[model samples]
Target: MAGCGANVTLDPVTIPTPLIDPMPMSVAVRIPAEFEDYVHEDEVLGREKWRIDLGRSNAALFSQLFNFMFDEVTILGPDDDASTLAIDALIEPSIDAFEFSVPSQSRTESYAVWIRYRLKVYDSAGDMYANWPLSAYGKSEKFGLTGDEPLKRAAILAMRDAAALMIMNLDKSTAISALKDRPAIAVASAQPAADEPAPREKRSQLPKRREVALPPPGPAAGPAVLSMDPDSDATRERVPEGSSND
Candidate 1:
């Protein structure tokens, strides 16, 4: 977010500047080519409602993550000059969902926002080998906040949380190994090659719920009789109709 607010400021997450390592492979992280319309605007709000550029925010944070993922993470930006980033592997990111809304109109002053994305990985040969999805969220609850304060908070928090999750969980992806090997010479852009990636084997999309058969109903059990406690003194307080003792 260039600026989440016009007046009200949210302490947004700063871009991470970590110690770069000298590993064997150089990686290129491609910024999102385009964002969905909502990524740049939110219709339900006051001033500065449409100012948050969530797509750019994600790309900036994701680039930081790339730094940690490889020895040298070169940002293959959206510009045409990508020839210097001779990378072994490439990471392409795209936004899938972007939304922000107040939790309740009458209660909290804060707002919640989420940004989801589909990540595509390519080997140096320019074949897309793997793809996956991720999501993040942010919230603003500070007092007297205004002018896109909530949106800013949401964007910053989402980026930080998403990066954290990537560090912990992205190892499970199949693309990591492919990203670290097979170097390629830099080109003007990391354009898709004619030889597309092999078709990935996807598991059956069917849900795993089973219909369990219940045994046929037998005879219904007899209702149990309730035995109420009837103390002699307690029973005397109840006057029977038409036989009440005056």
Candidate 2:
């Protein structure tokens, strides 16, 4: 409803309290200013203009969701520093991309929304530990809804889909639980002892540590499928083959 465009402003989203045990780690989540006030505008089929303002819904969603997922959750503002805080890990979540299709574009009675989110985790030492990307999709049919309501519902459902994916795969994907009470890496001494011989230079040195890449989550196909496929690009939703939209 913004000046000849279909405008949808979302309310703060809420998810059902999960029944799973929380991770036994104290963590801090820093919500960036941009993430809190995300907005998306696009024209569908070169005809209709649409604007979707998420406002503070993303901030509220993550704040509520993380409290349920972790034993202790400390929410931080954009300018607040986390270095002084005693935390096992720090997580920063951001939207990589957002896309949606209306009935006119898809030639169906459904509104589909796709959201791609990236999570960056840092250990107590503030070193980057893990980077995970997840994609979530939601579709709402235009049964009885009108005036951008279906699109709004679809967007909210996509957020709920994201919450569910995070609940199930957060630890599995990022291994954040392993950072519980993990100590920071100690700094090496500036100078070696005089009694010790100088270190020898090597032509090629092996890395001190290597990370194991976890496989992406299992495949799912549906209008409301939640995907954790790291290989998926942000170009568009990966609709199932042979589907009406495809």
* Backbone clashes in model 1, listed as residue pairs: none
The per-prediction tally of clashing pairs is 0, 1
Best-performing candidate as measured by TM-score: 2
Write down the lDDT of every candidate, Cα atoms only: 0.47, 0.68
For model 2, state the Cα shift of residue 34 in Å: 1.3
**Over the stretch 88-127, how does candidate 2's per-residue lDDT look in tens digits?**
9877788988878777767889777878788767777776
Considering every candidate listed, which one attains the maximal lDDT? 2
What is the per-residue lDDT of model 1 for residues 82-182, given as tens digits with 9 covering 90 to 100?
34446666666777765555533324565555566666666666655566676655555656665556557655665555564454445465435545656
| All candidates: TM-score | 0.58, 0.75
Worst 10 residues of 2 by lDDT: 206-215
Give the clash count for model 2. 1
